[model samples]
Target chain A: MPRILRIAGAQMGPNQRADSRPAILARMIALLDQAAEAGAKLVVFPELPFTTFFPRWLIEDQAELDSYFERAMPNPDVQPLFDRAREKGIGFYTGYAELTPEGKRFNSAITVGPDGAILGKYRKVHLPGSVEPRAGDRFQQLEKRYFEYGDLGFPAFRGPAAWHAPVLGMLVCNDRRWPEAWRCYGLQAMELMLIGYNSAAYDPNGGSTENEAIRTFHSTLAAQANAYMNATWAVSVAKAGNEDGSGLIGGSVIVDPNGVIAAEAKTLGDEVIVADADLDLCRQGQTKMFNFAAHRRPEQYRRIVDQVGAQPPGA
Target chain B: MPRILRIAGAQMGPNQRADSRPAILARMIALLDQAAEAGAKLVVFPELPFTTFFPRWLIEDQAELDSYFERAMPNPDVQPLFDRAREKGIGFYTGYAELTPEGKRFNSAITVGPDGAILGKYRKVHLPGSVEPRAGDRFQQLEKRYFEYGDLGFPAFRGPAAWHAPVLGMLVCNDRRWPEAWRCYGLQAMELMLIGYNSAAYDPNGGSTENEAIRTFHSTLAAQANAYMNATWAVSVAKAGNEDGSGLIGGSVIVDPNGVIAAEAKTLGDEVIVADADLDLCRQGQTKMFNFAAHRRPEQYRRIVDQVGAQPPGA
Candidate 1:
């Protein structure tokens, strides 16, 4: 029998503002226990899994802001959740707002080993929203005001498991809209892509109604493209529910190497979606039918770097 | 002074069944004349520029099909268009339905040099729609029945004027949706990418009204990503108008090396969009902001080739 990696997309409900760290930890521990019980080798949580997507509101005070962003990964309060996952022998992906030591901040994700050691860290690359307050009817998405641009580039690392297979990547909510994130990871030949998101129900521009199915389909389409193009398994999880009157749609999915949806969560609750994926499938897709490298021609793409406008200040 | 390529986007209108090759060729020649008048080095036309987007409707008769697909590129009829472009000292990119000698049919694009020589040919890689008939309300796009999947992989070629400077590459309509097309060409250092498309009005599946602007945005976004990621200039032209009552959206655009829309056509007629692109800008972008080659990790991508499925029979 071919060795299979049993991965789970842990789709959790909203982490309300009133929810404390211990309460969230208990909930996360329960999820890990459930995933472990279901024999999942890995479980992926959504972006800002511990709290609400706080960047939706604007903030000016420094003290109140520090409360939202974490100073360290395993700081005393969140240590138990890591310890529980290690105890459960299940690796996981979690997203958070990181307040760096250098006084800069970033929206980031962390992949932790079954032993609770940090496997890899990825900062969100494509930051959306305005840096300063805007004069518009659109809901204030202060991501740019809250977080600095990512300093950590695309980097994949080996996960701690019996197989010791390399599963390289990351994706925050909005990063899925951009192809560069997947391209960067695909160029790295990332076997497993972990993306977590907290997408709002209302389109700030008021384009389409908050259709949950469409959002889910959109997520699946992106996953399908990434899987087919890069020959990697893309697992995306979401935090869904009415968080302080704002709805976050949830349709967590696990896409196989062939761009097929192997398993997906149905309800908006704490659910673990598991699927057995053969690592060899990704290798097969890349080298055979969709062999991008073998048929690639880089010479014609030399114009991609040609600058159209004057270079920005400081080179 | 650095060498620059002045390319023109020949945004064409509808080409109905009753519309003869002479009529279409006349429009193309006019566009070439306009491009030449604008001092453009090359002009690009849309996919299957001579016929209605036939794949939108299913057809099975072999004899009826033979009338639509072209047996040759400059087959007596299209020769005049080429002759006119050559006479005007301008290169051109045009899409056509090809019937190969081996009995295989393909939706292909050809790059014609100023001297009327065929510079390069590309068969579209991504074949959209079903192979067999589907029982549904959706407008069945039967491309698989009409044209075989492309065998000629993405290949970039050196144009007449620039041998070592920039390699030119081609992609057809649906191929724009896939990043592999850009990446494949990017790897070869393709300096200029010419993509031609003819998108229909209906969503085929009857989901939502086809957003031509969004589709156009996708093209520009793809061009921008490819340009920023690979440091290449991409010019995408389209054939717009209701052909036999099927409305086609036209948003032809010329994107420079830094992913900026340099010039664009507003009308869905025989419009000529010209823009000057510098080759040195590509080198600068690659060496600076979008330096994927220098910072990219290939070691992790070893699994990309190791995972292909078994080759299809008779390979």
Candidate 2:
């Protein structure tokens, strides 16, 4: 039998300002149910599942900003999701604005096992957007202002056997664009990477988004690129469409180790897509082609870590 | 003036079984002339441009195998093409099998300036195919039996100003499939990566050629992925079509920093594609978003070097 795992990506539309946390969770659970019907034991949801893209606005009031964060993972409001998942024996991964008891904030993603136990958590290491507000942009990308850089580096996990015991890892939004993010997980030998992104179809500051197609193209390109290069499955979910007049692109997709788009969401709204990811395919990448252990010239790649970032040498 | 360099990719069909070294050089020169007509200052040609991909067969006689290699870069047979290029003030990159004076064999690629000066040379670091003969399949790939691992690592160079003086690097065939190849250039802060690949349309060993589309999709995906991730231009040329009964895939393409296929060749045969590479656009990648120097989490990626290849943790 093929080591196949039916995985689902819950592509979401934008969360409205009036969206209650309960309404969002209900939608998430409905997708989970849909995934189960499609024979998926694991489902992945879009980033910041509970609220509108909070980073789009600059909130001065502390409470208003904190409102976007999930103070605790299994709080009263989200308990239903865990219970429903446990009942179905389904595993899941979700991205949310995280607030610590001491008031520290992070863009975090958590992986939960089939038994409803938290398997592993990953904070967005490659934080994108801006730390400061730029009035010229259609929407402010103030992730830097709102959340501290994630200190918890990329980590991988071997989840419950029900989900095919996938050696999995997670990333949030902008983290997907950085090659290093995928390499870290690849180095950890992650078979499947669950990624949730809240990408603005239009980044006014970049100016390239004048044709929104560029934004979507780039978004999917990152997904396809990492999947092929790392020889791993990447399920990228997007919270797309207009949220309070701010448009975002939606091209949620499942990429095979060969970087082929096995299945993709067509609409910019709430949608669920499922596909059989033959984990055995990764074995080809591991043992035959991209077997990193045998071929990587790590001794030469030392500069990847020693340097702060790529500098145009002698520029 | 836009900091743009009009670059061309000379995508060639397979060197016919009857092709002589002189005949191949003539065809290469014709492509350069065509590129110059398109206002190109630089052109890239596919790997093993002089002869049919020889690794597809096993050779028992040493001198018989050595016949496929160029004893020196400017041997009389190739000097005419270099002279023609210098006359037209066009810089070019080409991949070929190189046999050193000391009889060292390597899958090599070299970059030359408009003035016909050798700018840089790269031996294919990630040689694909097998060393030992496997009788289970139709063709044999004995790259290990033929070439030594490259001692000279990936390096970047700034050539003549006519070619935009963009920090450039080169890789041959199998190296493009490896993410580390691109990352090495990215870490060196290269602005353009010139690559040449002669990939078989079907691998008899991997019994899935029923979907020949998968290999094509993967070839292009690898090109686009590295282009976007490294925030650099990648001009990938292919030697395709049937050579002595073995078929190769040809999808020579020019990918921008945005991972967009700025230009591509449609035919699985000899073709040329050129595009205006806005070197300044790399600034957007360098300064705005993919500023690798600022964002890469290298410290966490130490394992990429510590191990031989990626092994799932606890494997």
Candidate 3:
């Protein structure tokens, strides 16, 4: 299919806990307008765009915790975002904390068509952060404590492009860091992959003394590397800047199949990085240099298939 | 066992067609001397270090074709390298064309202990280039026509260091570009990964018009990405510089578990990139951030095991 998808990675500034959902969605709409003005057919927003990375903090009160979850995607706060996308005839990918009617909390990202209909949804499969709260830690990265592991596997959807729609898939935050997470979309032969991340400068490992820039470097590196390896166009957006005193690394990026960063956002504020990505160009790498069909030796690799050695020494 | 091996990636310039095995071995010896002098316990060399990139040309004569493969590892010409390494109490990794007594041919790399004993061997699995020569091309890459697919799947070696030896695995040339190739080593939880390559500046896909620097970028990108994702130390050495009439890209690099380039070769000629890698640091990414044992999702990933969607739309 002949496809040229002009896409944008909309990096959002920090969302303070005091900021209402309307305030965040209004900023998303502004970014959407900028992306549309830049001739972007689709724009991808950061993970939990409506919240200030709520999982970074540990809350004891149940009422305060429930306040972080989105009861429905198009609740009054987000309907305007859908309205703006429809008006501009632009598709978008956005992430948020989803709480089901039964009160099951899951980290989710969804793709919306230009007509404001949901195309597909993916949960954050490779969730980061420990469940136990470390006393001395700068931030409580108790993601596992706040939300459950995403039940949804990486799923691809037919896109909202004008014609010759590109295949699309969704990944969130830490999922972008794992090569295994991107492999599923690669297997589906996805043309464009969207990932939303909330990367903090806080090093849970106590390894990095460098500023938030370390996460920015790693975030862009993984995005470009996965795109090049899989022969797919990947867009990574982030909730960057300091939020509630926690500093975040904000380097949202768009990478082509050659591992080249085509367009990248420089600032730690509301920004839109746009580039016209010819999905057709992704074919050369696939057909010539990296023909997975001809080159991949799946049968020989029993380790990944069997999960052999994917265990600790005594376990 | 406490273990730390000071290693070097001994990058070499291409061997001209007129160059003798003695000439190539002499250069390798010089590089090894520099490595040993620099306190390196192990050194790694490029694929087919003793010969020019022979697959770039097509030879119809059987005698002329057979001349490219080495009859034995420690045969007269390369024995000097072994003798020097043993004398210096240093181990090394080197790649070469192997011809079995039964007339089998394979592109292989072997790990040698300080005592000049073969610790382990691996044959190149992901053979690149094509059998049918594409005429009017700058350089022909018909490796599939010359060498057989490596029989040895990426194997792990347990020795070549002091007590508490680190696990080692080998990859040759084009094999470094494939994620599938690196996964096997990562699955084995290899402490250190060795790769030797002969990368030509020529582009086969007719896509890149840029110089050899592009290949250098790709080589380093893949190396760092694989190491970071798998939490292993990866060293890539190359046969660089203009060889014969064709130019090769050289940027030998060593990347740590954090996907940071610890050391890199500056020139396209014979150069040694040395680094002292602390083996223990690799554990944090494995045990904390990456934690493959705790984080890998094998159950949902049926495509890899069943090879589903691996093939193109049709056979």
Candidate 4:
């Protein structure tokens, strides 16, 4: 059995802060329909796809920050998109801001089956930015202050049977750049990785030489290499273009186990890129080159678990 | 002060099994002279540069295999190349098979400083190949049968003051593809990474869809992405072209902390690729995006140390 699945990436343009809720949901539903029309069984959407990338600004009011978070998933505001996906018989992986009843917030993502059942959930573990806002900066990255570090570890689960029951994993934005997170899922034999990112066109932290091209290159480089290392198919979608006066990069890609780009987004807009991923293409790497049982030396990897920071050698 | 150190990759052409030791050393000394004339402070050479890739052959004769291993550092057989490097005031990194005093064998490498003093040593940790040879195969990868797994973990050291005394680490061949090996050095705040490889143009193991171009792409991809993720400058050289009737890849590269290629080898023969590596260029990534203290969650990465193989989710 080839175990082939047609997957889609819904790369969206900027969702301005002034954009209404209904307008954003409409765009998402349209993307889902486009993917379904292309015969895609699963579509991946970008992080914080429902609204503007709010972390670029510092929110002073509690109500304003809370408004961006979904107190409960599938709540009335976002039900239409879910209903549309179900009607089209298409599954989706999407990111959002989550708020628990106890009031804790997290940068989160979930995989919903074609029948509108949630298959898996993941919170962003590698959160970038700072808790304290930098003074004298026009745009601030306050992800550290807005959301708590994800407590749900990298977990791998099986997709619905129609999708070959593939072992699936999820990552959001910056989390895709961390190899440790990928390694955890790899140990679980994850066959497909879904990622959603809202990366800045410039250095998210002020005062660096990184530009839109370099940032986009970094995002793509991370996705390709991590996918190759883990021997899995990957779909990394982006929420890109100028959002809320800050520029976000857009180079969404669907990469194979060999790190080759199968299909890529040409513009930072509402685009649907599709690729027929042969899940078995992962076997060559998984069984030979990336055979963890034959190659991995965990005893020599103590530094990865024992330390959290770089500790340079003495003077 | 800008700590700019000019580095060169001494990518060697093939050394046929019938080639003489003096002939191989002469080629290496010529490369050393070329790098020194170009004002390079440090030069990196490929793994087992002194001999043909012996792992490709199944050597049943113990004496023949013993001839390939170096019994002592700076032995009489390889002194002229070291002398030439010292004469030019150039430091270098090179790999060689080792036959220790206790008769243990290992695939190993060393970094020699400008003054002819050894700065650091590392054994290849992720050795790729099987202990048992596949029956009816023309080429055999018997590294597992010939050498023990490297006991010395990834160790980071510093260069001489003339080379800015920058923190440096070494990984031989396949170790470069394993992110865990890089992370160990990254935890030590490694500034520059040196690598040497003799990867095949085709899958050394029989029966796969891989080819020369894809293998070369994989080699470069690993170097670029690992260098970027670890926020270090890297030089990965190759002993390329056909050796002992088997083909080898030659995409040796010099990569910056941003994962951009500074220089790359254009041929499969003797090539010298140079790059002016700014040590300060690593600061931005180390201080921001890759600041392990701020972003890494080791508590959730226990799987990396606790297991060596993939254990897929239950039935």
Candidate 5:
């Protein structure tokens, strides 16, 4: 029963577009009271982390793009970081910009738990940029002209028996470089994933083929190879610096299911880090090198869902 | 007009179950004349690169496991390393142990082409170990008691118009740590991949939780995050050290398409490692952050082809 947990991450640092909403919920309730004073019990935080990465703008006012979404999640501008993470019993995970009551828009995320409920939610299935607006780009990703794609899919849940309930999952922020949204939460054996990002430390298409240290080494090598090919225990985080002139890219990590990097983020801002994790080190890659029912084949996967694009052989 | 190519990887090192077959095709025609004197127009080579990783022992002799398969693939003892890689016009990729004239058995690989033909053939569909035989362990992965799984699926080919024909694909050695076999050859827009492995530098189920420098950093972090989430240009290679007594792992990379490490292998023995690549740097990740039709969703990847294992939430 070596479940362990502890977690943390936080990272953040840029909420500029005239930051407010009580200053980004007081820097996310001070990074959830410095990750519940370092004993952690979850935490995460990043992908929209409440604004200033508002899809790098092209808003064209619809009340300034519905004032960067969230028509309800904990409503009162995020009920004081969910009433200070349910008064510090902790458990978090973030990302936002939702909307919906028949209005639709996505790029979501969730996770909550230590009694504040919401365990797992996702939505943000690999959206990267454009839906118009790139002509002369001075920062503009527009998340496909303002959200929609993620119709809630890569699910996976549980995580409550005080973190021992580990399965958990959640992506957002370019769905951490899509390995089919971490093999659909690693076919549900998911033992803690929770990502979040802001990315674009350059190369948001106004290209020079990526910069900002190779897009922070492609965002920590896509969270250390999709958390070592789904043996789980990831973290991701990041919101990073220079938002009022777009930049982002912090390299916040955590990783390990042997993807290594146990705690990273040598600062791009609010910081926090931490680690502990263990979840039985994802049982030696889910019982010896990812025993997806003894190495999955899914009938050699139907071109991963009968093709979505890229056909180039004779094309 | 900047397609560039020049690849290479060779790698090799241990063949010893009393080596010979013209001394392993004269060490694969001396690593294909040292990757055609380093001008290398593609080379790769590893998975069962002709003998000695005989599924690490447990063989009960059927003519000694049909003397390690390959009944026809330039047979006649690998025809002088495919006539010296078609007399150095170069172009390669390897792996072996096939058999098929209906008697079945796979774990293959191919590729050939600098005019010598072949151009593509893959088999090893993520076949790893065991088909029974664990109990007293003294090394025995038995590749599921002698191959089969790869009924030819992750195809993707082309590569000829003097290398600019790119596309290509192929994976062996635990199907390069399966991202659904690199998203089924990155949905076929492939642009170069070609792997080959031998893995295990310890922990081939004797478990001490991996070693040989974290199994050569999980075999170059699964070829640099599946060649940066399939914006292609890979390589992989490696057969590496100590055979008859186990141990394997040796870096052997090449990567690119933003996964970076363009050429590695600081030896585990016979090396080669070159690079060049630049197939238009896979068009900045297939037109902006892996544009699998402006970012894949495939009905939220139906739990990666409707589940094969790990259904853990309350199960």
Candidate 6:
């Protein structure tokens, strides 16, 4: 019999600006209670689960931006929910904006064990948008102004509660768009990948509605390719629904090691998508046809990291 | 002195159902005339330049599908465009749906030399969507139903006009999504990559609008990465406009060997984007820090082609 690990992708509704931390925590606790009742060993939340997508609008003031980031994981406001999850013996993944003491901000995620202890923390690597204003008319996505590139490279850790079933990696929204994130974790032999995202509607300068399907399919295809390539079960959860008139389309999903969509959420609302993943299946996948480890030709790829526009020694 | 190729990306507007092949061919000829006037040695047209995106609707009849595909290039209608280009001594890249003599269909592109002879032919390798019906409320993307998986791998050929330039490669719409296409061509020392696409608005079922910016950015980033990594010039052209109520966004662009946007089309309409690509600059990029040829690891990847699932050994 395969050792089945039941994981729940908790797709939350939009986090309105008016919503308080206590209210969001109450909702998260309710979700944990529900997942615990459903017999889920782990529950994953979307990126920045506690707040609205702050990168969409441009904000200049430092103190104004600081208010959006959490200084500590379970500061006084979020301890009860973490305490409750520990009592229920369920490991969970959560995403938020983090503000370090050195005056730097990072989009980060944390994995909490059933015992209420933190298993590991991961900061997002690929920072989207730019600090300077763009020349075009599209909505300015000012992520570079808000968050710094993560210091942490892609590292998979062995969690205490996840020992029986090794679950190793995590990513935030924009990080999923790049294959390197999954490739890095795959190189580490990560068995399970938990990724969360918070997306907004309205084309930032509003081009055409065309390529929407391709855009979404890009993610699903990435998940499929990454899962099959890495031989790891990938669970991607999203925070859907309109926040401050910016609608977020929810296509939260759970893919098996073979890249099959086992379960997926339907709408931009609060919902739970569960999938029973067999860790052995990933081992089987890695050993079989979809193996990237066997077919990659690094001998021919020596120029991948070479910097362009570098000056010559004498020049 | 650098051997600079003046390449032009001919961004096209909508191709309506009522637009006859002759009418479309006339427009293409006009674009070619304009490109020739501008002294552009090479011109690239969008994917499926003759017709509107037929993949949007799920069709089953063979005759209807055949109608969407081109039976013969330069067959009566498009011959004028080719004749004009040949007369003008201009090499061009154009994409179309191909219906073979055996009745198999494929998304393909062809590069024609100044003498009107075919320089290279490429079929899209990455086929998106389901082979059969999808079983839910999800919007059906029927690419697998319409075209067969590509047989021809990434093959680069020498251009007619540029005697000193290196080999050039071609890729179609969906093929642009995968890095394997670029890597395959890169391994062959392709100094230039030409890609054509006709992408629809965000899929109403699979993706939301929140990912628009990243999706657009991915297009440029992919080109930039490929150009930088392979020491090549990459040009991507798009067919933009609302056709049959479906919108296609256009941001056709040109990226140099250094991964900078040398030129870009103004988002919407029939426009021409031009850039000067120097073979010597690409050679310089290849020799620099991002040189993939000098730094690859083949010993570690030994499992990429091992067959998974239930395939019988050598059966």
Q: In candidate 6, what fraction of native interface contacts survive?
A: 0.00
Model 4 chain A is weakest, by summed lDDT over 10 consecutive residues, at A202-211
**Root-mean-square deviation of candidate 3:** 2.6
What is candidate 3's local distance difference test score?
A: 0.83
List per-prediction Cα lDDT, in the order shown.
0.74, 0.84, 0.83, 0.93, 0.85, 0.72
In the range B1-315, model 3's lDDT, one tens digit per residue, is 446678899999879999988888899999999999999988999988989989988778989888888899888778999999999988899998899999888989998999999998988888888888987776788888888888888787676337257878799988887776787777777778999998877664464544576667888999998888888898999899888788788989999987899999999889999998888768877777677766666665666656634332112
Local error of candidate 5 at residue B264 (angstroms): 24
Q: Candidate 3's residue-wise lDDT over A2-42, tens digit each?
A: 57889999999999999988888889999999999999989
| Candidate 1 CAPRI assessment class | incorrect
Candidate 4 lDDT over residue span B164-250, tens digit each: 989999999999999999999999999999999999998555656889999999999999999999999999999999888788999
lDDT, model 3, position A126: 76
How accurate locally is residue B89 in candidate 6, as Cα lDDT from 0 to 100?
Answer: 92
What DockQ does candidate 4 score?
0.89
RMSD of 1: 12.0
Could you give me the TM-score of model 1 versus the true structure? 0.58
Q: Candidate 1, fnat value?
A: 0.02
Q: Which run of 10 residues does model 5 chain B get worst, by summed lDDT?
A: B202-211
Per-candidate alpha-carbon RMSD to the true structure: 12.0, 2.1, 2.6, 1.1, 17.5, 13.3
lDDT of 6 by residue, A1-315 (tens): 566788888989988888887888788888888888888888999898887887877777878777788899978767887888889899899998998888778999998887887877888876666687677644566777787777676667765635354757888876775455666666666788899987554354665432334345445655655665567898898888877656665778898775668888887778888877777777765663334343343333333223212222112
Q: Candidates' DockQ values?
A: 0.06, 0.66, 0.47, 0.89, 0.33, 0.04
Order the numbered candidates by DockQ, best leading. 4, 2, 3, 5, 1, 6
TM-score of each: 0.58, 0.95, 0.94, 0.99, 0.39, 0.55
Which sections of candidate 3 miss by over 4 Å? A135-138, A161-163, A204-211, A308-315, B1-4, B135-138, B161-164, B204-210, B308-315
Candidate 5 lDDT for residue B249: 84
- State which candidate, 1 or 3, has the greater lDDT: 3
Regions of model 2 farther than 4 Å from truth? A135-138, A204-210, B136-138, B204-206, B209-211
| Model 2 DockQ class | medium
Of 2 and 3, the candidate ranking higher by DockQ: 2
